[model samples]
Target chain A: MSLHLQPVRVATSSDDSESQLVFAEGFLVAMLVHLSEQHEDDAGRWFLEAGFGRIPSRDHPTFLDLDEAQTWIRQQLGNAYVS
Target chain B: MASNFTHPLFPLIRKLDSIATLTDEERQAVENLPVRIRALRARHEIVRHGEKASQCCLILEGWACRSKVISEGKRQIFSFHIAGDIPDLQSLHIPLMDHDLCTLTQATVAFIPHEAVRDLTMRFPSIAAVFWRDTLVDAAIFREWMISMGRRTAFDHLAHLFCELYLKQQAVGLAGEHRCPLPITQGDLADATSLSNVHVNRVLKEMRGKGLITLRSNTLVIEAWDELIRAAEFDATYLHLQKRAVP
Candidate 1:
């Protein structure tokens, strides 16, 4: 479902916030949310909107780095490039 | 009128602008085509993974499903293609298809040859943008589906999908008053949400018991909008139609 326009989307310093997360279109929002909540510092700080009514975090698994994280994210999004 | 497919789905292509660009006499030169129409029974496979795609399949009738399978046979459905959808336009570029498309209801479709579609696009550039943007919107819809299937819960997933299909079909004048044609079965719903059939059935019952939604005879009537939207945690930004209004 997630198709990249560039080879890899480089996250700029400007993009290092919850507000810019709005620009992260489509399934990318879901991917970043996983990375942000699980990876903590590596992912980015979360912006909680009282609107989103989930348990926030349930499985307290150790978070992954960027490269490894993107793989898991892409898998969740159902990439044709991967299995 | 030989051509009447001018709708909001055609991006960057103005309907009135097209009138001056192409004359009715010249437009008439290309045949409107009497195409062969076929019917697909509910839940029947119209196209499967690895099948050679040759025709431009247009969903002229009921709702249909498109999905892909993952490792350990985990299935993830991309999105539903309703009327006016050419579900496989991107398949032309990829050569081999990696997913399956099936009818969720007793559906009817018009098949146009690939070559004819290319010719048709060349002949009608305005309509071409419409189809291309339709494909772009199709990709956007997949992005939303990916979110629901991968992250959202069973009830949330169903609610988000219901909201999405209702809005999309409404745009085309196919849906009305929170009532929409949804022929998807509980099993099919499970496949889309990445949940078990029992889970899907239970979720449906829960929603119905809460009086949030109702499903009977292939039609879904959403009785509570705010409750359903809150359950799904869905926002409509991904569809990207807002770019048209920024001026």
Candidate 2:
């Protein structure tokens, strides 16, 4: 059977303002998050390692908060998921 | 008689012969059909969506695909065509194009008028039956694709596509020995398979690691045909090739 993305609940840390929205499908887990400044470098490295690229001059959009990150994830998923 | 290769309907004749035999008179009629040949560059649009087509585009050389651009400029490719294939043959009856037909490589195309096609079909019932059968087979392929998208895994879908394409090219004498020309990009494959480019690359890597197939320099070589077929659960019944290869 084909793998399909299923959205999991959004999680937020009490000590930090950083938010993560997780999506799961079979053995794959995709995490979309509003990266804090300390985590930006690590996130960029991870994105590059994941083939998303991390060229400094590249115009990759950065979301400042959870709502923007959630919207971006939704847009990427398109009609692949229900609700 | 001079060489049949010199005939205007050579590609069409070869195509029909792969599906059904034609009488001498029917062959003559096809040779006499009016056509305007055009050479197009890769990515050139032969016909656009919402356009009322007056002629059908027949691929004499190179490849073409029918696709639709959806939201976010994401294009979904429906079918690929090669020599002896009419990418827009449905336009003869439908009149209006609901999707775009474009070249995937530098291509030689013959534009046959719908009026002429209609006249030919009316005069030759046997030839008309062949064309009808061709369209029916096209529908069958579409159904198979829908099944692939709805039920098959990405690896299975890619394997199935490779199997189908190889058989198609082999039927037309363009491929043999489990190898075929695959002049399409990872992105193109992604569009056709409804997967992302990254995912396609990953799947291809997995296939390579499994020793199932090798795709390089626009050529795909099936290293283990039986294994690839098994992975895909592929059956060529829907393809309807007259001279089907035993797998």
Query: What's the count of clashing pairs in each model shown?
Result: 1, 0
Query: How accurate locally is residue B77 in candidate 2, as Cα lDDT from 0 to 100?
Result: 99
Put down candidate 2 lDDT per residue, B1-247, tens digits, no spaces.
Answer: 3656887657788888777777788788888889999999999999999999999888988999999998768799999999989878889889899999999999999999999999999998877878888889999999999999989988999999999999999998899999999999987998999875544665787788889999899999999999999999999999998742221
In candidate 2, stretches whose alpha carbon ends up further than 4 angstroms from where it belongs are: A1-83, B243-247
True contacts kept of each: 0.00, 0.00
The TM-scores of chain A alone, one per candidate, are: 0.29, 0.36
Candidate 1 lDDT at B203 equals 67
Pairs with backbone N, CA or C atoms under 3 Å apart (clashes), candidate 2: none
Where is model 1 chain A poorest over a 10-residue stretch in terms of lDDT? A47-56
Lowest lDDT block of 10, candidate 2 chain B: B238-247
Residue lDDT tens for model 1, B1-247: 4134552222112222222243464344233533467888887887789998887677777878788877666666777877767787776566477889888788887776777777766777755655666667677877787787678877788889888878776656678899988877766777777665444555676788899998898889999988888888868776654324110
Tell me the alpha-carbon RMSD of every candidate. 15.1, 9.4
The candidate 1 chain B region of ten consecutive residues with least summed lDDT is B8-17
| lDDT score for residue B49 of model 2 | 98
Error of 1 at A41 (Å): 48
* Model 2: chain A TM-score against the true structure: 0.36
In TM-score terms, candidate 2 sits at 0.77
